[model samples]
Target: MADIKVIIPAYNEVDSIAHVVNELPKSVSEVIVVNNNSSDNTVKNAETAGATVITELRKGYGYACLKGLEYIASKSKQPDIIVFIDGDYSDYPEELDNVVAPILEDDIDFVVGARRKNLREEGSMTPQQVFGNWLATFLMRLFFGAKFTDLGPFRAIKYDKLKELNMEDKTYGWTVEMQLKILKKKMTYTEVPVRYKRRIGISKVSGTVKGSIFAGIKILGWIFKYSIK
Candidate 1:
């Protein structure tokens, strides 16, 4: 079996972090939850749920995820695959096997757990999120002939391929940035339909006007920047 590790970027997800950690499949060798400067009991709860918690201090999803990657880089034995998931309890954590299967079985470089509309619960995604996904994906198709349908966070990538991408996004643009880089690098990728539900507590990105606007800008900026490059 390939060694796999999970990275979860959490910001003030005290109410839902534990559930997300506890539900992860046991095949994951380590569950690293990077607490993004949460004032609540996020760290404590994640630790109690058997996740190795790290503090990013900086409040960005990408920052927290980078911290987790740094921790893995310091480990004596690195993982074969890295799976990134959100700590909002919206995604079915137990379905991680489905996310990584293509990489393990077919030697695919990347796999995204696409939250198909048929599998998503009502209102799981906000209006802005839906439109933004559509626009960004449509542009990816138009510009690059990419087949991506959703910019879902629940995704997995080969460790070496991930390192080659040199991911540097420190905020809302992380997911799209990865996708764009994958396209530019000509990496093999696939998507697995996954179930999504209303997250526990409010969403940090889609729940606020400021977050929505910034995320939309960041996502579109990555697409357009790559389109011209």
Candidate 2:
């Protein structure tokens, strides 16, 4: 079995952080939750749930994720695979094994947990989120001949391949950046359908107008930026 590590970026998700931590499949060697300047009990709850909680004072999704990567890079024993999941408990953390299965069994370089509509609970994704996912993926298909369906947060990637991508997004462009780089490098990738449900608290991105606009702009910016390259 591959040594798998999970990274979860959380900001004021105290209501759902513990559930996300405890429900993770024991197959993962460690769960690291990067608390992105949360004012709630996120850190304490994540610790109680048996996750190695780290604080990232920076306030961006990518910043928190990069902090988790930094912590992993410092460890003497490196993981074989790294998985990124949200701390909102919207994704079924118990399905982690299924998410990483492609990478472990098929030797795929990267995997994204696709939140297929049929598998997703109604209202799990807001209108803007749905449209944005569609538009971004549509653009990817048109410009890059990519096959991605959803930009869902639950994902897994080979540690080495992840490092090779040289991820630098410090905000909403993180997911799209990874996908674009994978496509650019011609790396093998696949998506696994995963069940999804409404998040415990309101979303930091899709729940608000400002977040939605910024995220959309960032995602689209990454795609277009790569298209011209």
Cα miss at 21, model 2 (Å)? 0.7
Residue 2 deviation, candidate 2, in Å? 0.9
Superposed model 2: Cα runs more than 4 Å off: none
Model 2 lDDT tens row, 1-229: 7899999999999999999999998899999999999999999999999999999998999999999999999999999999999999899999999999998889999999999999999999999999999999999999999999999899999999999999999999999999999999999999999999999999999999999999999999999999999
Error of 2 at 120 (Å): 0.8
List the pairs of residues colliding in candidate 2. none
> What number of backbone clashes does candidate 1 have, counting pairs of residues 3 or more apart or in separate chains?
0
TM-score against native, each model = 0.99, 0.99
lDDT of 1 by residue, 25-122 (tens): 88999999999999899999999999999899888988988899999999899899999999999999999999999998999999999999999999
Of candidate 1, the 10-residue stretch with the lowest lDDT total is: 57-66
